[model samples]
Target: MTVRPITITGEPVLHRPTRPVTSFDEELRQLVADMFETMDLANGVGLAATQVGVDLRLFTYAFANDDDAPDRGVVINPRLVLGKISEEDPDRDEEAEGCLSVPGLSFPLKRAEQATVSYQDEDGVQRRFEAHGWFARVMQHETDHLDGKLYVDRLNKRWSAKARKAIKREGWGVPGNTWLPGRDEDPFGH
Candidate 1:
């Protein structure tokens, strides 16, 4: 598997909705493998198809759950169901989120504390999984990608303005802006 360059936020592919995964074949398997590799190399919890310039409704995640248990898998053609969000989070600072597409910058955003995702695996087997706390955020974030929304898009005014400045400073948000995980300098500074 090869590590693909993750597209920056302004790319058209990331702005539009992704197509659903239909054939669970060898090609799909290869793509998932490559995405996992890319996500790991970039030290990301989750990576979506649009981030890698693929317009499919699939994402690979490899991160410990909210309970510190190892949770890793690919979600294909997912439908995410979210629980109520607590607006007044005492640990609100912990909710700051970043994206591979946006590279280094992070901004605090509200997200559901619980989520249930119904999806298919790489083999096309249907499955449903529930997540709580930060894992729920991961699921929600990745699901947003499939619908052409980025974490930055959901940021509140204060953070959104700051995020916009950062994007402009980095010369990102343009088509064809990408960085290879290992080869290129990490904009987020690892």
Candidate 2:
């Protein structure tokens, strides 16, 4: 498997809604493998097809576990069918998340505590799986990417401020000396 370069924040493809995958050909399978490779190499838990400049609705995610174990796999044309809500918002449990596209920076974000998702597995078999805790968060994060969303958009005001400053300092979207604070930071800070 080959590692594909991840597209950065300014790339228009990252925001464009992904097209559904129509074929599960060898190329698509290989792409999934390569995505896993790249994600592993970059120490990312999830990656979306659009992050690699592909417009298809595909993603790979791995649950973060000790012993350096990799629970790696893919989802093709996946759709979220259900989620569980605890008395506490699962996503409000803040943890540091990093992205392959947005390199060299890690910031805090919240993710769902539990979720039940139904999607087509690699062999075109329909599968329904229940996940909670870290696995649920990974699924939520990667699935959001398929819908053209990013975790940074979920940061609270204080966290968003810090994240935006770091993103800008890393030169993510702006030319040298250009400061676009409002666009750079999460205005809503939800």
Over 1-190, each residue of candidate 2 has an lDDT whose tens digit, in order, gives 8877777766677766788887877888888888887666655678898887788888888775432223766877777644644433223335677665666556767665666677776677776667676787777777877888777766667777887887778777532222122233322221
Off by over 4 Å in 2: 64-70, 81-94, 174-190
| Error of model 1, residue 23, in angstroms | 0.5
lDDT of candidates 1 onward, in order: 0.89, 0.68
Best by TM-score: 1
For candidate 1, what is the TM-score?
Answer: 0.94
Give the C-alpha miss distance for residue 155 in model 1, angstroms. Answer: 0.6
TM-score of each: 0.94, 0.78
Highest lDDT: give the candidate number: 1
Error at 186, model 1, angstroms: 2.2
Query: Each prediction's Cα RMSD?
Result: 1.9, 7.5
* TM-score of model 2 vs. true structure: 0.78
